[model samples]
Target: MSRKRLLPALALLAFVAGCGANAAADDSAKLSLDAPLPTAVPDGAKIVVGDPATEVALKLSGQYDKVSKYVQFANLSGGPQTTEAFRAHALDLGSVAEIPPIHATWTGLHVKIVASKFRQDPLNHPIYKLGVAPGVSVKTFGDLRGKKIAYSPGQAQGALILKVLKKAGLTKDDVKLVELPSTGDVYAQALAGKQVDVAPIGGVQIKRYLAKYGKDGASTIDHGLRDDAGHLYGPVESLEDPAKAAAIRAYVAAWGVAQEWIDKHPKEWIEGYYVKNQGLSAADGQWLVDNAGHPDIPADWSDAIQRQQETIELLAQETGNKVIEAKDLYDLRFQTVAADAIKGGAK
Candidate 1:
């Protein structure tokens, strides 16, 4: 069926199911940063791997239905709005890959780690690379010294570059990092013209420029990028996990379904969610839909928790703030569903 038709049915289902949320309940959400969102944590929910609740509300970063397909997972508008909701507790479940939630833990927010969305290599995402014009001879991370790198500030991918650079024996001091605002396209355009030595590309844009696009536009200076896995694992934090583990399973299950859908019907997925909804070109959207990490969500919450802790520690160091422990921020009890559902396949 066409997505246009599917959406109406989904919208009707959501309305019938009464799953939508009132954005008005979150007037303060607009002003504050995202805190841990509150969720209906059912008591004594069995720790069945991979079975998080299906009907819970969520505060997703970008529009998720473009990928997930299920309707009415009430959330903040998109990235910026959802982020603020996480800060304000206007949401019960929120997803972010880095920085925001890491900082939230320090303030003693109600957020807790329930589950994770693992990307094979975050650096490979167009959102995370340094794109150079064809004229630039910068092919490796070593060439970034004294070159201008433009990107959004404090984002996980940006910080990841710094982290990896430090591992590579460099730091922010090695390059001139230019902070851009909403118009990262302007930044990319700047890179294409060599105005900026390197314009950081995130998500599949990195893939597009590196593998698909012609050299006439842009190319990756793959020096600092770690193929460690080109995908990223976004942490889903929530407050009140009465079902704790079970809730996670449901989410993961649905995620798998959504991923399978993307694979089986790539064109529909791109058209319905990416090109039209996200306002990107078909090529850009296709790059995203095709390349997204479809690995099964890890049932072993410990690995994700540890990674989050590392991210938090990094955040603390960056901000010079008091420390926040992984144990304190992660509410394992809420992920009973995820614990119950995972069955060993993660790419």
Candidate 2:
């Protein structure tokens, strides 16, 4: 919730769940920034939004101010807050993990994915480890049949847990889902306090726990549960307006710049955000710099959208049968713009 903050105070947990942008004329041009605005453009960019982990890059690069001149961005907390913003039509441009947009679509919210990228790297997969309580014996998803899980409904972790359940031939009814406060170190605290059987954690939380408890004290279950993508979205109403639409396009292009910047300057990013902002150690910062690759803002959705649709469908199985197709959720107008801005392609 704090502006430009990386992960929360709890190091390891924040590392796992920390949320994450910018602009230029040539970059904006790729997104049709030069398009003539409608005579009656909106007065201000008063949309509530999320942090999305890009605030640092956008600020450091000085692109945030350039884009904000046209599009007013109001920052919210993270995934849970952004989900509510979408539900209430309180946000124009927002960022969230995969599940929020799917929920919006099912609720008939006119939101579309403007940009997206897979969160995992094949070589350096994110450390979303499933750590069980000291006394519990949940070694795999199948072992979660009667266990209590730390879950935040409609968030990325919940969606992931559902996928693991499905793969293990288990259902939601087979386990006990516990809701934990998203603020601070709730996930780590819950696990340490023996409140939940299995807690999916990362970064500082994992480091601290493993150091104090050791592998024998706190067991981890690695089910190869990785590969999730984050999305930047906006309401259709704003996208239909000429002025806001231009701003949105410009933002998309600037966003690509910010994403590239993070990947290119991982060391600066770690120091500025992970170490300085999130209170992580030099070692923790270096780990993130080495592992958390820059996000991929896909220029083409043919393959990515299909993967997203499949992910949504898998989660929907737990939320009832209201189906949401890829066509209903994505606005691909900016794909070319993203392609123009990103140098190495959207991988």
Candidate 3:
């Protein structure tokens, strides 16, 4: 080829490459948080939700069938599984605490929380209590110093440990943090086996932990910190889709109604959810219900957002993660969706 012809060919190749790079950049661009959300769920709209507890609540309340057409409830929960699903585009929405959203942001997966719920009296109804291993002396938070504590970095339980330490006027250097997965009965098992001096244990595991190991000197003490941060979050890409956004809006409202139903119909919830679905005894179910107090879904997320900011700051400091804005992690368009749904009596 002549030199002039070759030069033109190279220029064309460069132009094409630039266009391809720009297209890729557009694909990964962040969705505008202020973008208008469609009020109505379009026909054939669908979302894969990973919230089993909510699934049970909806089923027990007889509200599942109403949203089943557009909502596919996957038997998936926790930060790890939910984040993986989000990465794979397998999950449209996930139920998790504040930590997952923060962690997701840090790991380059932008997510936004669409709904938030807290216990009516969060401090009194904390989701977790510190479980002390047999023969380990940890009567108070101060005693956590120099003791081995179970920690799961990207999980709420691990974040709770850091919060507990902060409340006690201690730092990570003050305690030996034992890296562990806070899944199922792992925390309880670790406590019983004396693998760690302390760990945060919640739900039925709290009762069973003390029951099975109480004689062996295992005990749980209230951490006295409010850890009731429940949220429904999705990847930015998923929430950006108009159909999925509308479906999520509807699901949030139904979720609020289901929560109210559970609070009102404790016996039914205990029987249908804890007893039959989870295989727990009726007594255990009652214990969980009494301890959970009542659900508090606030229309204003100001307080929640402020608390999340503090959490992000703390986690960022401890983990060397970038301190991102907590307000950006929430979609204010959904600020009142659940509350309005509950108020409208939409069963």
Candidate 4:
């Protein structure tokens, strides 16, 4: 979970592309991948990605060549894992969320913003629901003020829930906050014959629950977080000033390839990228793409800069932390390179 601001052109691009960033891996060669370039990529533009440690991400080059620039990657896997990696000086660039970096920044992990990343549409209101076990008599957020809830505390959705609770006139102290290790299937251990009355289950988990329980889904569990909006993913690195600037250049160069491919093959994207994955049903994946994505490209770094400012304000208020100035969080010189590639055709 990274943070980003919405550029006006990005908003416009959303309207035009009608698909969100980070939707699916491109699977065609027709992808131009280098339309909006600021300059010709240097002969040695390479980047390192230490993201959520997903095997899919580690293997992204198979889906698109633009990502080849990221020839080296380190998987921090996530949570304190990524934070530790950053602190140990194992990574140059990684995408992270607000709270972790806020803490990391104090520990000498200086983060530099690369570009605007993906965010769930606040307006669209994604399908985030609250789930409860068999005997837990909870109906609304207010009902569980004193009940114990399980989530990946202090990150992504966990942070969002903290903000939501505060706004709802409740605090983390109001309920028992059990920090689940991560957000995957192993969560079953919590609910397996244990008094795990609550958990932050998602679509992946929900489907499994329904199939195993009664094929009808539990009736007690309902929607947890409703106001679906936040700055999502981005590329950031803990590097010396000189090295950070170098990584931004490489990412911008690669993003140029990704965006052009999306722009050029607008029609085939959902079908090609979504259908390629074995785990995702083509139909369901297509629906996810249609409902949540917008692929229209950004016109300039200025637009992303404005987005960074807006996101910083929202995040600061939400987290009760000091707001980082836009200039402090992001650098646009790399994006200038991307914009140039888009307009002049990739060099």
Winner on TM-score (2 vs 3): 3
Residue-by-residue lDDT tens digits, candidate 3, 134-211: 999889888999999999999899999999999999999999999988878999999888899999999989999999
Off by over 4 Å in 4: 1-45, 51-70, 75-79, 106-108, 125-128, 188-195, 214-244, 256-284, 287-291, 295-327, 332-347
lDDT by residue for model 1 (134-227), tens: 6676766677778777755445555565665666666677777777642335656666666677776666566656654444645765444432
Error of 4 at 19 (Å): 39
Residue 342 of candidate 2: its Cα lDDT?
A: 66
lDDT of 4 by residue, 1-347 (tens): 22132233223333432321112123232212222323334454443455432224224424334545533444433445555544443444555544454445534555555544333343353434455665566677777787776666445546555655665688777887776764456444465434455665543455555456523234334443442322212224222222333444555545555555554553455445445543556655555545544443354546545544554565566557677776565544444555555576533
Sorted on lDDT, best first, the list reads 3, 2, 1, 4
Going through the candidates in order, what is the number of backbone clashes in each? Answer: 64, 11, 0, 22
Q: Looking at model 3, how many pairs of residues clash? A: 0
By lDDT, the best candidate is 3
lDDT of 2: 0.65
Candidate 1 lDDT for residue 240: 25
lDDT of each: 0.48, 0.65, 0.85, 0.47
By TM-score, the candidates rank as 3, 2, 1, 4
